[model samples]
Structure formats: structure tokens, C-alpha cells
Target: MERQLIAALAALALVAGCASPQPAPVQLVDQQQYTKAMRDNSSTFTWPESRKPDLAVLAEKSGPGRDRAPSGSERIVLEITNSCACYLGWEDARKRGDQAAASQALKVMDEVLPKFSPEDPDGQRYARETAAKAKAGDGSQAADYVANNCDSVLWK
Candidate 1:
């Protein structure tokens, strides 16, 4: 009876160990890795060399400045791009009729949209328009606008 009890405990311990949850896999992709992957993947966007300088400038100007935060237009452009990406992914999922994936993507966009500057008029306007459209179930149109106009609005 003693030996049987020990074996049962050992088996229970093994089962518990096997049932332990594991940490999620980490995804580490640096800029170089992203650039290389984008270059190799024809479907992915490869940012132009000419726009690198502008991107660098924007990166530099993004954080808090001496007087105030970056301009509303700048913040709007950034938020739009971010939301647009989410919407685009959602659009793809919607195209496949994957309601769960689409809903998840929209949830992500909803979380991000409110981060835009409410004080900035242009930013507020952009946010309102986007939110209205999203609420009206025009996510695909918003995604298309973002994918098509990112260069004009963002890079310029």
C-alpha cells in the first residue's frame, strides 16, 4: 500500500508538471530584420530611401519638445497610420469572413484611436471622422484610404 501511494503521488506530480502553462513565444524583429523581410516579401511595403530622411526627422520630433508636444497634424498622421494598419488587417480577415479576427482587429483599433490628441483640432477631427466611419461599419473604406494615402499624408 505504501509503494502504491508513492507511485500515485509521483504520477500526479508528473501530470501536474506536464499541465503547467508555458510562456508565449517571443517575437523579436529589429528594423533591419523588418526591412530585409519587407524587401524580400513582394507583398509587403518597402519604404522608399528618399522618405528615410523624413522618417528620421519625424522620429526625432515625436517626443516632448521644449515648448510643447508635436503638432496635432503630426499626431493625427501617426494615429491614422496606426489605425489604418489595424483596419487593413481587419479588412483582410473580414474578406475571409473570419468574424472573430475582424472583431479582434477592430477592438485593437478602438483601443488605439482614443490615444490621439483630443486638444488638437485636426487630430480631433480626424479621430471623429474615423470613429464615425468605423461605427458606421465602413472599416474597409477607412483601411483602403489608409493603405492608398499613407504616402501622401504621412511622408509629405
Candidate 2:
């Protein structure tokens, strides 16, 4: 009986150890209430209600020399990440040769490239050349193109 009891306790210990832990409870706050709280607080800056999502509020708050030209670096980074994801997906679409998937990825890159800023002459030229190369089936040129020109023109 003692042995059976010991075995049962051991089994209970094992079962307890195997159980998954519970997640913490999340607290949800409404936007207006949060905004009101922020406004009421002396430490925080109160934002106007008319401020939209796309407004450069953070940049504005950064003060002088913050309102520079809109560079496409962020867009370029997003595009490059998307392109890499598409390329990996395309690779899995066929056994030996998936020309269709490759073509689809190329089309996506082409569509996204034109949306980049042409304000920076060097970046613009590099972007155009890279897009042309990509269209011509030399997609590998993109990494080199980005590395050479993206930091100089896209980023601040």
C-alpha cells in the first residue's frame, strides 16, 4: 500500500510537471480614455485630436533638422524583405524549375520599385538600373544595388 501510494505521488508529480503554464492576462484601454489620461498628465505632451495616422508627429516632436526630405529607405527596406520572402516561397513551388513563381516574384519587385523616391539622383539612378536588371532576369543584382546605394540615399 505504501509503495502504491509512493507510485501515485510520483505519477501526480510527473503530470504536474507536464502541464503547460498559463499566459498573463492582458489589459485593454480605449483610445479616448488613454488620450485623455495623457492630456491630463503634466509630464506628457497633448496631441490634437485631428492628428491622423500618417502625420509625422514623432519627427515633429524631434524638433529642428528633423523635417528633412522624405527618403524611401524605409520603403526600400520593406521591399527588400518582401522580395526575399517571395523568393523563398517561389523556391518551394516546384521540384526542379518553377519559372512561373520566379516570374511572379519579378513582377512584384518591378511594381514596388517605381514607388521609391526619385529625389536623390544617385539612389534614383541605382533603383532604375536595378529594376531594369531584375526585369531582365538578373535578380541577384538587387542585393549589390541596395548595399551600394540604399544607405547613401534612402537613410538619414
Candidate 3:
């Protein structure tokens, strides 16, 4: 009886251990990673080489006295490209059951969109609304936003 009791308790402990929830994976999305992801989506956009964002300058904008943020059509291209990448990351995370990654992508969007707001309010508004829709699990709006906005650039 003593041996049987010990075995049962050990089995119960093992089962409990297996049933515990594992911590979700860490998926931090920094600016460089985000920038690369944005560039990856650039195939969906049409912009002149001069207008494409310089990754080094983009990485520095978060720091003080960094006035290198793009303006005019360049700024618009950056906004549309980042928004396209972010929306895709958000939806992919949702599909993969990685809420942390989705939220991180949105956080990156929040960090990026404001820098463009002063120069291009309309583009910022569109990107902001797309992020909000992603937070609400409405990915179709993001798709629509990217499709309708990205391809129409005149690339001057």
C-alpha cells in the first residue's frame, strides 16, 4: 500500500507539471527588424531609389536631434511601407496564436507613425486607423488600406 501511494503521488505530480502553462515566447520587434520587414514589403510599393528610406537614418530617428526623417513623397512611401509590413505582421501573429508578437508589431507602429504625423497628417491618419483596426482583429481593413494606398504612388 505504501509503494502504491508513492507511485500515485509521483504520477499526479508529473501530470500536474505537464498541465502547467508555458511562458509565451519573447518576440520583441525593434526598429531595425521592423525596418527590414518594411523593406521586405516594398515590392508591393513603387518608389524611386532616392525616396527609399535609409535604414541608418531610420534607426537614428528615435534618438535626439535626428532630423533625418523623410518628407514629401519619401515620407509617404515610408508610412505606406511600414503600415503594409505592420499589418501583415499583426495578422500573421493572430493566425499563429502569438498575441505578444501582434502587440509588439502595434507598438512598433505607434513608435513609427507619429514621426510622420507632423509632415504628413493624412498618411499618418490612414496608418493609425489601420493599426487600430488590427488591434480589433479586423485585418481586412488593413489589407484594403494597403491595397488602395500603396500602388497609387506617383514616385516623384
For residues 59-94, could you state the per-residue lDDT of candidate 3 as single tens digits? Answer: 333211212121122333455555655665666677
Q: Which candidate model has the greater lDDT, 2 or 3?
A: 3
Error of 1 at 81 (Å): 2.7
Ranking by lDDT: 3, 1, 2
Q: Which candidate achieves the best TM-score against the true structure?
A: 3
Q: Write the per-residue lDDT of candidate 2 for residues 12-34, one digit (tens) a residue.
A: 44455456385332222233332
Model 1 clash count equals 0
Prediction 3 global C-alpha lDDT = 0.50
**20: Cα error in model 3, Å:** 64
* lDDT measured at residue 115 in model 3 versus the true structure, 0 to 100: 56
Off by over 4 Å in 1: 1-78, 140-144, 151-156
In terms of lDDT, the best-performing candidate is 3
